[model samples]
Target: MTAQGLLGAGVQLVLVVAGAPLLVGLMRQVRARLEGRAGAGVGQPWRDVRKLFGKDPVTPRGTSEVFRAAPLVTVATTVAVVAVVPFVSTSTVPEPGADLFVVVALLTAGAVATALAGLDTGTAFGGMGASRAITILALVEPTLLVAVLALSVRVGSTDIADIVSATLADPARVTSPAGVLAAAGLALAIVAETGRLPVDNPSTHLELTMVHEAMVLEYAGPDLALVELASAMRLTVFLGLWSTLFLPWGVATGTGVAELALGAVLIVVKIAVLGAALAAAEVFVAKLRLFRVPELLAGSFLLTVLAVVAALVPA
Candidate 1:
């Protein structure tokens, strides 16, 4: 990669790491205020991360290096994802990182890392969390995969950059039936992927009701910070990908500094709007019983199938 590309990639990495916590804090603040209480400021997650980093990390007896390193792996995978996800420019940094399949694999790898970390702890609750999270993520993956596949089929490219570039160049694709159906499926996948309401609750402390939290319950201090930051980054990247792929209105198209700067501003605006909408929607929904989760994903699967079929239709 050229020096310019390296700089751009570094900028994207900083955005994912810094912006992830802000996004989480914003959502939490919104949720808190909507429920009629004073909320922590949007900077709260950053403060929490700083506090965690200053403290010591503790690992239980008999735990292996995989347990100690899982948090780092999760964070690194997310940063790598940000490098390719087109948050600023329609072109991914380093160029070759645009495949939709690769993005899915990276996302799955992060989840697997979390599961392994949980299992490595050798605690009953930790193993329980790992099993539940792994199972849910495995089910969620097919819908996400199929949704993107529908988009790829519509545009005739599996490279996210190319697919998005085509969509931006042709505004009509935004309104196509296939696009609409695929977006519906992707939206559901986003919810499930983020561990949000009606799928999993990010704020829940109840052991029986938590999936993401249970796995991380054994972590403390800096390790916990990495895990938390990774979770936040995962949520941010998913939202960014959703915006860049589906609503890519202001994404940068040129290599100019100005274009990329404008793209950055627009990304913040788009994700903020999306975050608020999600928070408001969460206020009204009850969590689905675990057994019912598959039904939700199955509905997304059907919509994606229709989207794929719709893509084959004459325009």
Candidate 2:
């Protein structure tokens, strides 16, 4: 990798790692304020993570290595995604790694690791959560793949960097019918994949309704801390990816210090705006009943299919 690419990757890594929790906190604060509650400040997630790390480690009895390794696997896979994806700069190194398929696989790997960890726990909640999580994953991954493929068809390349660069060059594409449809489908997939409102509630602990929270119920201390941090990072990463793909205007095209710095600032701003909007929207909506989720995802899949068709049609 060139020094420029490495530098860009380093900047992105640091940005995602440091900004993830703050993004979560910001969303929570937004929701709290809209509901007329004085919420915990944006730094509360950092404080909670710190406290969890300080506690004694605990592992449930009869748990195997899968339970112990899931947290690390999730974090590692997400970090790899952040490193390769062109969040701050299009001049990212190892461009081939930024292939849409590769990035999707990394995301899927992390999800699979989490599901396996849930199954390894052997508790009723754990098994239930794992089954539900896998079900969501099965539906979500295909939608994610097809949604991005709709964009890729126009660019003639499946590499994410190429798609972003193409969109940067042709700003009008963002408003085109295909672009609008793909964005909608991708946004829904992100909401489902990240366990957000109307799909799975991050704040819910009720076993009957829990998906992500149920799987991790048995973890404690540092392990739980890792899971929590990874979850935050995953949300940040997905939002960043969505922003880069659909709103790539601010991304740096070069490795110049000034460009990279500006790109970093813009990326943070884009994510913050999106997070606040999502949080605000969540306030007015209720989670869909469990059986209705697949229908929602199916609608997303249909939008993406239409997007692909639109992209393929002669102008």
Candidate 3:
């Protein structure tokens, strides 16, 4: 790879790492504002991470190596996924076969690690959370894949970079009805994937309602910080991917410095808008009950399948 390419990739990684916390904080702030309360500063997440990192590690007696190892896997997967994502237009970081499908697989790998770690603790809440997480993931993965396939059909490849490049080459494709449908499907998938409202609430600690939080109830210290940072990174990566694909108006299409700079600015703006929308969603919607999750995911699946068919088949 060229030195410039490597530099660009590093820039993307650094950007995601540095911006993840801010994005999380923004979401919290927006949600608070929507609720007619004084919002915490956008730096709140950074402070929380700092405090968590300085605390001592706590391991439950029933926990195994998997619990110790999960934070590492979670953080690593977030970094890896961010690198693989086509942030500045269609450019990918140096990695072998890290296409869209591979991206999904890596994400699933992370989820599996988390679920296993949750169950390893042998706590009732942990076991319950893991089981629910598994079911949600099982339903969400197909919806995600089908939503991605909707875009892939028009672009004729499942590689994320190729899809972005194709979309850039013909901007009008964004206005296509199939494109609109795909965007809707992907948006729903994003909410479901990220554990947002009507899916899972990040701010909730109630054991009866928590899905992701219940699994992490035992984590503390730097390990908890890593998990929190990883979750933030995951949110950023997914939102970035959505913007890169659907609203890539200012993204770079060629290996040029000016184009890259513009792409960077546009990406920032897109993410900011998306973050606000997510926060707004969280504010207005309540978390679904445990049993309601399956129906929600199933509806997403049907919408995604329809989107794919709309893209590939003749009207």
Best by lDDT: 2
lDDT by residue for model 3 (237-295), tens: 88998898888777775557776677777787889899998899677677778788888
Give each model a TM-score: 0.97, 0.98, 0.95
lDDT of 1 by residue, 18-37 (tens): 88899999999999999998
User: By TM-score, how accurate is candidate 1?
Assistant: 0.97
**CA deviation > 4 Å runs, candidate 2:** none
Each model's lDDT: 0.86, 0.92, 0.81
Candidate 1: where are CA atoms >4 Å away? none
Q: Clashing pairs in model 3?
A: none
Instruction: For model 1, state the Cα shift of residue 54 in Å.
Output: 0.3
Runs with alpha carbons beyond 4 Å of true place in candidate 3: 92-98
Residue 207 local lDDT, model 3: 81
Candidate 2 lDDT, 231-300, residue by residue in tens: 9999999999999999999898888889999999999999999999999989998999999999999999
